[model samples]
Target: MFQLGKTIVSEDILEKEFVCNLSACKGACCVDGDAGAPLTKEETKILEQIFPKVKPFLRPEGIAAIEAQGTWRVGTDQDLETPLIDEKDCAYVIFDGSTALCGIEQAYNQGVLDWKKPVSCHLYPIRVKDFTEFAAVNYDRWDICDDACSLGKELQVPVYQFVKEALIRRFGEDWFSELETVAAQYQKSPRRR
Candidate 1:
């Protein structure tokens, strides 16, 4: 791992590749996970504020789940997370045919809401663990994302490059710039495999 600002980033982000192939996986990440999407304290408030606007875009079951459980819940680990539907799919999930998608994002895409889904959803395949002094940024490998990994390898897109916008959103532009510089130097070094 290498330090960038307050984040300690894993080299796997630069070494591995990933690009979501929604068609292949059918958005399994949203539906198959045991827990709901992670949410920040601010995000829980945003969900509560935007629920009225985002409601129409969601599935009835999702709406029911959210209504029953609230927009977000505290997990056993005490971390904030979106509510789940029947302990399966996320409460904000909507279906585009058989494929699951984020209703919050759809609302934002349609201009019904300003916030585009939770940052955790936007930063898939890169989980951030925040501590008092810094955050650990690492690549998240899942069987559901195998197709994405293959597609990313085929497209020659590194994990860091693929999640550039999310990384910039999580960190700042300057932090991302420094990461790019580090990536450049790492690429030239024999340490790269």
Candidate 2:
């Protein structure tokens, strides 16, 4: 692990390759998880505010779930999270045939809401755990993402590069630039392998 600002970043994020192969996985990461998407405290508030605007883009079941459970719920870990429908998929999950997509994201794409989906969902494979002193940023390896790993390897993209925008969104531009510099130096060393 290495420190970036106050966050301790895992080496797996730099060593491993992962790019979502949506065609193969069909957004299973949204639907197949044991719990709903993780949300920041601020995102919970955003969800409550944007629900009315994002409701139109969601399925009837999703809307019902949201209405019944509220916009977000306290997760098993005592963290805020999106509510699940029938304890199966996330309440905000909308389908394009068999493909699961975020209703909040759909609304954002259509210019209905300013905020996209939760940063936790956006920064898949990189789970960030916040502490009073520093945050732990680590890779979450899952069997569901095997296809993505293969695709990423074929495309020659590292996890950090693939999730550049999300990293910048979570951290700041300056922090990301520092990370890029670190990546460059890490690449030059024989320890990269």
Candidate 3:
């Protein structure tokens, strides 16, 4: 791990490759997880505010879950997260044919809402753990995303490059710029493969 500003970033994000192959996975990351998408406290408020606009984009079961459980819930770990539908799928998840998708993001795409989905959702494969002084940023490897890894390998897209916008969103432009510098230097090392 290397320190960048207030974050301790794992080298795996630079070394490992991943690009979502939605056709292969059919958006399993949104539906197959035991828990709902992780959210910040502020995102919970945004969901509450935008529910009226986002509601129309969601599936019936998702609407029902959100109505019954609220837009967000405290997880077993006490972290804020989106609500779940029947403890199986995220309450904000909608389906296009067989593929699951985020209703919140759908709403964004439709220009119905200004906010995109939660930053955590936007930054998949990179989980951030916030501490008092800094955040720990690390690549999250999941068996379900095997196809994505394969695609990334084929495309030569590193995790950091693939999630460029998200990392910039989570951190700042300057931070990401510094990260790029580190990446360039790291790439020059004979140790890199």
Candidate 4:
């Protein structure tokens, strides 16, 4: 088992996993207006610079929801207090009574994006968090199981590398050093029940 400030977690809990399909999910994580997933100040700056370019693609309610929530940090519950957009599903999701389309992804592919948004936006269903110990959020619990939604199935990308880069970008080298210590411990002894 892996320990995070006295909290022991089981690594095998999510050893093998997949991505989530928005088509099947209500997109609660994105549209529920949760506040805990707040972006850092640097992220906010990047978003402000890039959001304007993709404004048209974003659903008006989605934009408003983000603004209402204000800024938040990773691994905290601060952002959960924000009000949900439709209460029925994610505001940015467009359902034609069948498959759901992500407006943000469409806009990005159309070359309308300004800045590199957080991986969270593009890497839905696979949430990587830097808590006392690193862990992936289980999207299945939310009933978001679809072949298209499985992140592991589509790309064999290295999650640790992505997280390291993201942390370096947000908190710089020093923060990464601290993270490495925790990561090393996790590698030595993965969490168990």
Candidate 5:
């Protein structure tokens, strides 16, 4: 692990290639997980506030689920997460034909809400585990993202490169720049395959 400021980043983050092949995966990551997307304590409040603006973009079923459950709920692991429907799909998840998408993001795209989707969802394949002193950042390997891995490898995009904007959003520009320098040096070492 490489330490940047207070964050611990996994080497897989620099080695693993992972661009989201949405057509191949059909946005399964949003729907297949046991728990809803992880949320910050502040994100829960943002979800509640933006639900009204995002409601118009969501499906009736999703809306009903949110109404029945709160905007977000504590998962089995006690992590705060978006509420799920039927204990499976995210309550805010909407479908466009066969592809699942975030309704909250749709609203954000339309400038309806200031906050986009949760950082956890935005920073897919990169899950952050926040501790008292620091946050552990690691790549999440799941069968559902095999296509993404293949596509990322084909395109020669590392996980950090693929999730650049999200990383910058979660961390900061300086941190990302440092990571890029570290990644460049790491790639030249021939130490890891």
Candidate 6:
């Protein structure tokens, strides 16, 4: 298991060997809270190209804010005062009885749209905490229950490879090296309770 601050997670849970029964949860992650996630420059450009309507919502300044403050708010009700979407919670969510799917995911899969998604969408459950030693990546179990959710079930080798590529495309090679160091440290650390 991995530990980040107060959160604990099992590595086995992250491996693709498991399958997430999100159908049972009815896409609870998407509908209940804000669709909070970070958008890289590439993602923002792609989003602007595809979803012009959402272009105004992409905050370049907010990215700097998140880098400085470690978090930022995305999406709000019509009043625009309350947070409606975040990294762990997405408000424009829909569950078709079983298998939680986001409209963005569906659109990308259907070829109706094309854009680089935010990092949060790419790295669900796992969050990256910037650090001088190494950026800490850990699972956000509190976002959902402890039930084993298989991220690998929906992922194929090509998709996984693409995600890795996207990471490089978004954060550059240096960030990946830093992530490797963090992963190595976690592997060497004592097991979490």
How high is the lDDT of residue 186 in model 1? Answer: 90
lDDT of each: 0.92, 0.91, 0.93, 0.46, 0.92, 0.45
The local lDDT score (0 to 100) that residue 180 gets in candidate 5 is 97
Model 1 Cα shift for residue 138 (angstroms):
0.7
Query: lDDT for model 5, on a 0 to 1 scale?
Result: 0.92
Least well predicted 10-residue stretch by lDDT in candidate 4:
73-82
Please say which candidate is ahead in lDDT: 2 or 6: 2
Across residues 1-193, which tens digit of lDDT does each residue of candidate 4 receive? 4443423433432343444445555454554443323344465555556655655775677667556643222334543222235443344444345555555455767878644445555444334454554543322233444443356446632233334454355446874565457655555663522
> Where is model 1 more than 4 Å wrong at Cα?
none
Model 4, runs deviating above 4 Å: 1-14, 22-38, 63-76, 79-98, 114-116, 131-141, 146-193
Question: TM-scores, in order shown?
Answer: 0.98, 0.98, 0.98, 0.49, 0.97, 0.48
- Model 1 poorest 10 in a row by lDDT: 184-193
lDDT of 5 at 45: 90
lDDT of 1: 0.92
Q: List the residue pairs that clash in candidate 5.
A: none
Which candidate, 4 or 5, would have the higher TM-score against the true structure? 5
Whole-model lDDT, model 6: 0.45
Residue runs of model 2 more than 4 Å from their true location after superposition: none
- Model 3 lDDT at residue 12: 97
Tell me how candidate 2 scores on lDDT. 0.91
lDDT of 2 by residue, 26-50 (tens): 9998889778898899999999999
- Model 1 RMSD in Å is 0.8
